[model samples]
Target: MKIKDYAILISVIMIIVMMVIPLPPLLLDILIMINLSIALTIILVAMNTREALEFSIFPTLLLLTTLFRLGLNVSTTRSILTNQTGGEVIETFGSFVVGGSAIIGILVFLILVIIQFLVITKGSERVAEVAARFTLDSMPGKQMSIDADLGAGMISDMEAKKRREKVSQEADFYGAMDGASKFVKGDAIAGIIITIINIIGGLLIGILVHGMPFGEAAQLFTLLSIGDGLVSQIPALLISTAAGIVVTRAVSEGNLGTDITKQLFAYPKLLYIVAGTLSLIAVFTPINPMLVLPVAGLVAYGGFTMQRNLNKEEKLEKEASAKSPELDSIKSPESVIDLLHVDAIEFEFGYGLIPIADKNQGGDLLDRVIMIRRQCAIELGIVVPVIRIRDNIQLQPNEYVIKIKGNRVASGEIMLNHYLAMSPGIDDDSIEGIPTIEPAFGMPALWVNEDMKEEAEMSGYAIIDPPSVVSTHLTEVIKRHAHELIGRQEVRALIENIRETSPAVVEELIPNQLAIGDVQKVLMKLLKEKVSIRNLLAILETLADFSSQTKDPDLLTEYVRQALSRQITLQYAQPNQALQVITAGASLEKKFAESVHRTEQGTYLSIDPETSQLIFQSISEQASQMQRTGIQPILLASPGTRMYMRQFIERFSPELPVLSYNELEPEIEIQSVGIVNISSGAVNMS
Candidate 1:
């Protein structure tokens, strides 16, 4: 240990020794002075701390100080009883401080005890108890808030960890203070008992053993006892006061002295009012004008000085505002680096739509956006990055745009005072409203006012308010671009999450069989096809099994899909319902297999443009027929051709799902509603 550590240990040992050992008067006086100095230093430190935790060691310090004072009291009592005098400090306090009157000295000692015991010690104990209870009760909420900030990317993992540690330290500090305040209370009682014993014991010993007169014994012993009490109780009062200050202190930017002066003198007008009131009292009452008038004049002058200073500060601030330091900052070379950082997701709206996001205006768009992120996390199984929301002056007043990595992915307009009403496959001419298209799905809709909202609902139209419209549009945009959002960082986060529960699987798969980037590719491919990676454990295990066979993400993803056949089947097919799909004919599958070109890098489809056009036309016809029949078009192909077919279909219809036969469950029946053939121009329905 360092010297300070050894010094603390030695000081504690000395306190323990003082209780049992006798000491000379000069040494006792020196200890008494040191006790008073320590008390002063503690109280000063308490006042200078910005928060209670800054003085976290105070509870232990309080206990030690209380023990030291009690030990001193014991030593002084032994000296006064044996030698008929305590020490120079005690005698000086009894004679000079209390005017050599035993009654006066006793009264001073009692008053100090009352202040320390009934006032400071009692209040400090109660405050500590309440603070500890409240701190413990608020711990969960503070932890959740920290987690929220961490999840929102407002703080890093290290910052969140530090905040959590601080919260725990605050709880422990208050709890210790609650118990330590009792030591101060007990010390007060002990001081009173020790002083009474000293006076009574000294009186008996002086008369019987030393042969002193009754009046003389009473006089000398009472003076010595009261003096010793005063010396000890005064330090006890200071230490108790420090305990109260530490417990009651709030977290602030400044210490107690600065906060007090800044807050107390915040309003100079209050000082002027008080000065006028004092002047009126001086004029009307029997109070001496000579005493009150000058005091009032001083107060009024202070107010004037404060007001002038405030006005000067306001002038300086206005001058600073006029200079436009922000423009100068933008011109600096360092500002260019700041512009390079693009948010992963940004939602920018025009000024008129601000009320939809501002809480004071009763807008819940921001809340809805948070829910959108959570919903995407549950459905897509990816950590959505923090969505930065701001206002853009260039857009139309009612318009908002959603951007992914600085590129606008989707845009929509909202009418604040209206609701969107989409027809239920039948338009009612009676429900008249402004025509618009639903931003989320491009369904035909109308912006109906409140009057027509009820009417449109009664007419079987789906009603959606402006907030829901924006939320839905934003959600769909996120889901559509989720693949682009999940990079190596997100993949690493996912791997870490999995490592928490299934460490063996994660350790075996990551960097052992495939790298994070390789895993990211597989997840992105799954997400692009609207597959949920929420079953991450299953996905990881599948990769761990097949990754050694092939390092290719595409082949590994195909193997993963086959492994998740039950999830894929349940995703698209209803229970006991035959899945209706457009089946690729033998000739089309052959064409896809033949078109697959293999390089050392990977395999890719290299079909001719003419054949691609014919294939696109054939698939479009089948999809249109399925749409007419109210069925979503899902193409079923062989496992070898499924990935190539998806790649080919993504160019014209990126939203389409092309599944392999192995991706479906064995229990489910497959119904081919249409057939795609290269030889034939159209799809043949089965």
Candidate 2:
């Protein structure tokens, strides 16, 4: 083992040795000084530590110090009873510090024991008990919070592990302290008992064994015994005080000294009151003005200095506040760009529904927002901005709005203390309340009272609380606007992230074959169609493969989708189930391909309005049939027609998802649910 590792063990062994073996006065004196040094060092460390956990080893150190003191007491007792002297250490304390008065020396020792045992040690033990109990009781909750933070992406795995270890250590330290505090208490009792026994035993040994005169023997041993007790008790009191400091300290930015100065002198007016009180006592009381007047004058001077300093700080703060705006304007002129910047997504609630966002009222909308951004980044390749939330007093108490770029995309009102009740997406159940529509999907719902929540759930209706309703709506709004949130900055950040893993792909595609704006357009096109860009390297690699073929974003997006076909197929197709879809008949596909117009602007379908209307009407009929059969309404079209068909479908059934044939995986089951044939002028469902 290392020398430092054995140092504590060796010291502890020496303490045990001291209890059994007699020592010379010179050696005893050296050991006595060491005891005082350790005690002073511990107390100083306690004062300097910002919190108890910082000095987690203190409880074990307390036990060691107490044992060392008791052992010294035993050695001193032996020396005093066998010979007329305990040690140079005890004699020096008795003669020099206590002024050769045995009574005064004894009284000092007793006072130290009383303070250590009754006041400091007693309180320390009780606090340790409570702190240990509470710490253990709270361990599970603290662990869960750490897990929650780790899950929420607020902290990393290593950080969470460190925090959990620290919590376990805190619980261990406090529990050990609860028992270690007893060591100090027992030491105090032992000091008192040992002192009394030595006094009685010394008187008998001196007069009876040595045949010394009674007066001489009593005087000699009494001084030595009291001094010995004083030496041991002094160190005991120091450690007990240290124990108290460690147990009682709270976590703070600074140690005990800084906290005291800042908090005690926080109010200059309080000091002024003290100065006035001191002046009144000096003037009215029949005390010596010589003693009282100078003290009062000092107090008044201190108060005046504090008041002057406080005024200086206040004046400086005011001047800084007054000058900040002009200084900022001069350094950086006002620009419309700064004022025009807006939150990509914002959630605002009225005063009545403020509880849904307020943390103190058990709301978790803020945390939910963090989770939403994370989910979107995983599900759709987008770094959604931190959604800003605010209370809008002008809004109806129960109303909230979800806005994108300062435009309200959707809004709804909810009952403050009610739950949203709906049948499991079925229109059969007729449970009634205040009629409302689910904001996200526009499903029919009712606002039912809290007491009716259990009945609704029991009756097979889904029940959602007010906060969840708002959060669900917010989630959908961000998803729909995910494409808009990602711009050049977000795209650059994504590319930078990709560069870390796939630098060659990013280097090959940008600036050589295409610019960053073109790549951004491709990714935006994918996002607009609800494609996830989380696998950015794959997307970039696919873009790199095809950028030389075409600069058109719509075609590049199609190529990216062809590469991500497996993901797209699984997204709509259930596991091992037929991928039911409505197909654009050959005649319709032929017509769309024939009408496709190419220009420098972009490739677009140039079919006349009448032909476009006819195609959409057929697609709508097929979509209604798909919805009725509980099939996911997906349309299969040629890669050339898919982009234009998406635009066509959006004008009518905005939520209908469309994909090209290349976007489907080779192995997926293709069950044609219907056909869209404008020649037939009507759609048919299988």
Candidate 3:
């Protein structure tokens, strides 16, 4: 242990020894002085602390100090009764401090005991108990707040951990103080008892055994006992007051002295009023003017000085405000640089829709955004950046807009008091409501009031609340643009996350075989086609294998998709059911193969505009025919033509799923509901 650790151990041992061993008067005097000094130090330290936790060890220190005081009392009581004197300190306190009167000495001691026991000790104990209880009660709330901040990305894991630890430490500190305060109360009671015992025992020993008269014995022992009590109780009082200060200390930016001066003298006008009252009392009342007038003058002078200083400060503030340095900074070039940065995703709503995102007004949109980020991470294997939600005054009251990379991608309107009811494939004529389109799916929906909600539900219309409507629209917008959100930084984060468990695959695939941009491009391609990259290990492993052969992201993505065929198959194919799809005939595949022109930058399809028009017309007819049958149209093409086919088809039908033959599992039976051929210009069902 260090020297300070050993010193504390030795001090505790000496306190125990002071109780049992007989000490010389000189040693007792030194110990008493040491006790007084320590008590003074403790209260000073307590007053200087800005928060209770700053003095966390105070509870344990209080126990030790109380024990040391009691030990000093025991030694002094023994010395007073046996030797007819305690020490020079006690004798001086008895004779000079109390004016050599035993009655006055005893009365003073009792008053000190009353003050410590009835006032400081009792208040400190109660405050400690209440603080401990409240601290414990608030622990769960503090923990939950930390967790919420963590989920919202407002704080990192290390910051959250630190906050949680601080909360726990606060609870423990208060609880220890609660128990330690009982020590102060018990010490006060013990001081009173020990003083009484010393007086009774000293009187008996002096009169009966030392051949002294009753008056002399009473005078001698009573004075010594009172002195002993005074000597011990003074220090005890200081320590108890210190305990009160520590337990009642609240979190503040300043110490007790600073806060007291700053807050107590906060208003110089109040000082002037006090001074005026004092002057009136001195002038009109029977009070002595000579005694009160001078004090009143001092108070009035203080008020005037303070008021003058406050005016000077106010003038300086006004001058600073007129200068408006903040406006100057805003007009600076550096401030304009900040405006160049843009958020990855921004959700802006009109002022009337503030409650949709404000938790105080019963809005859960912020919570829903947290869930959206998590959902994206789990389903798309990419961490979605924090969605910035703010109110825009320029928009209509009910309109909200969703932005990706500073560009508005989607917008919708919400009625606060109405529920959106979408028709179940057929419009209900009986349902009377304002017609609207569901922002999430663009399906025909109605804004029905609370009165019509039940009828709409009974009519088999899907009922969604306004918040849900906004959240659903926001969620779809994020999913649709998930690819655009995953940049190189986000890809690096994913790589680091996977590196913890699959370091080999990550190290081999990233930078060594392909750059983060390359990996990001592959992931983006997968997300664009609505593929789940949750099984990132498989994706990374596929990239590692084929990246050496080709640096092309498109080719690498195809390889990854083929490796994730089982996932793709499970996503679209139903159990024990044949996967129905629109197939591209041999003629179209051959045409795409011939039209593919290769260059250094990669292959491109250079089909003539006539053939392109025919392809689009034929594909649209087949897709429309399949849609009429209530089936999602998926165009199945050979591996070589699938990427080009998807790239070509996305211009008109971005939502359509274009799957390659190798992207499907071999066990899945393919049933062609329609075929796209160049000559037919329409689907031929077979």
Q: CA lDDT, every prediction?
A: 0.91, 0.84, 0.89
TM-score of 1: 0.77
Clashing pairs in 1: none
Better of 2 and 3 by TM-score: 3
Candidate 3 similarity to native, TM-score: 0.77
Query: Better model by lDDT, 1 or 3?
Result: 1
- The collision pairs in model 2 are 381-533
For 176-289, candidate 2 gives per-residue lDDT tens digits of 999998898888898889988988898899889999898887778888988888888888888888999998898899989999987888886777678678778878898777
Clash numbers, per candidate: 0, 1, 0
Off by over 4 Å in 1: 1-38, 71-101, 122-183, 204-213, 216-221, 260-355, 358-361, 381-399, 423-436, 455-460, 486-523, 532-591, 610-641, 659-686
Candidate 2 C-alpha RMSD relative to the actual structure: 7.8
Q: For residues 599-622, could you state the per-residue lDDT of candidate 1 as single tens digits?
A: 998888998887888888888888
Q: Estimated TM-score per prediction?
A: 0.77, 0.66, 0.77
How much lDDT does candidate 3 score?
A: 0.89
Model 3 per-residue lDDT tens digits across residues 160-198:
878999999999999999999999899889988888898
Off by over 4 Å in 3: 77-85, 140-160, 204-221, 325-331, 349-386, 390-398, 414-418, 432-436, 448-452, 486-686
